[model samples]
Target: MIADTELILNADGSIYHLNLKPEDLAHTIILVGDPERVPIVSKYFDTIEVRKGKREFITHTGMLRGKRLSVLSTGIGTDNIDIVLNEIDALINVDFTTKVLREDLRSVDIIRIGTSGSIQGNIPVGTLLASEFAVGFDTLMQFYVKSYTAAEQKLAEAVNRHFSNLSFSPYIGSANPALLKQFAMELPKGITMTAPGFYGPQGRSVRTHNMYPDLIQKANSFITKEGLYITNLEMETAGIYALSNMFGHRALSINAILASRLHEEFCANPAEVIDSAIQYVLNRI
Candidate 1:
């Protein structure tokens, strides 16, 4: 049987697929998708310490405004998320580094600051969108559970029939209100759509063309009776919300709206938006 942890690399602890260890992180963490962005975030740090990596998973732990935090890259998709979330939880919750369980492990605050395109016109470029909720069109959760909640099922039924969506179904998801609310003053709040990919998954055109030409339009028009909106499109927010919630971590996604294909415009300078989010979170957290 596969166990929770098996020491392999350093021999003193479990070496996750990412190869990160207990000492490699801080309680306040920021996760980006690109390894290059790791240092971009770390540049705001007050002091530098541990730096480790394997493949696209690059890690750097440092102090920002006297607050120690770690910034790491997950490469892409829910697959990498599955690996990072579980092992990070283990590092703090389990006692594999020792022989006893460390139930009192410090809870890490995880915030994903990344770039995404706005599905709607109102959510324009050069703004930071803090995702209050994420709607997943990915099947990562399917391996864990066979059924969806009533609301999730309802969302699926609605979106599926409208767009003839398949291969993956929609799942309603949310982040920790406390965590999201903490940075409320800094970023624009919205309901983000977590699409599986940039091409067919998000209604993008290639030489072969998109099967659902109106899917993006349909998405821009969607809303629940509760007045929730899907304002932005991204790859990782849904997985982040679902896994982080399940594992008892407060998580949020701050997406820089760099492009709105509907308007055919770009952010002009998206790095400014990213800087805003990084500075805001660094201060608030």
Candidate 2:
């Protein structure tokens, strides 16, 4: 039996952070980093049936092309990803009334549509990319007991050896192969580096000094034995992939490239790029 302290729930029997019950969730979920983007993804729905939110988490469930789907926001970073993914897994797999795990466990398809910066100069602004794998600079995955596959282990070793000057070890997580094959056939795909913050963690300096000034150069030059490169930088993909694996759910991160870290360029029309990326995923999903 799970303790109340461990699996906390609201008085309304909805999952604590997400404020959603099992019925309120759909089998396919779209995760966005911004709360306002929740409605942007759902606006194309045939009919929106549920709308719920708490803090930065907002959810909308509706139908599109006779398929039921839901869009939820996780704000930013792996910390928020931890809360949103766990609460969502509990909503589908645990009985809130009984405070126990359900006999018949369920799995959901999680798709992340978010903006990111291209670490490779070849991948220019306004390009849409898919995260085949993510290298987490954050420590979120350390708390969870996970076994890395042979390929994942090899990739992690490469990243660690390349960034040996860094203080902490990085971890690797991957997208669901089934989802990758389904949606990434026509898109450019590569490894994404998930940073803990937008500024210093991602090697940006304002007033404060950056610890690893050559971080972007090292990342851009990193190549795997399999010949893959670290292509983009973002806040959530690694944690999303990690927890989705832990929960037995299918997860994919589709990124809209609005900036190029390698070339120091930002897209002028960010909204148009985001809207197009949203429509692209919607049409395929």
Report how far off residue 52 is in candidate 2 (Å). Answer: 0.6
TM-score of each: 0.88, 0.98
Worst 10 residues of 1 by lDDT: 1-10
Best by TM-score: 2
CA RMSD (A), model 1: 2.8
CA lDDT, candidate 1, residue 284: 80
Candidate 2 Cα deviation (angstroms), residue 222: 0.5
Q: What is the overall TM-score of model 1 with all chains considered together?
A: 0.88
Candidate 2 per-residue lDDT, tens place, 35-98, comes to: 9999989999999999999999999999999999999999999999999889889888988778
C-alpha lDDT of all candidate models, in order:
0.77, 0.94
* lDDT (10s digit) by residue, model 1, range 165-269: 555567766767888778775667777887777788788787757767777788888877677667988889888888777777889888878899789788888
Candidate 2: pairs in clash: none
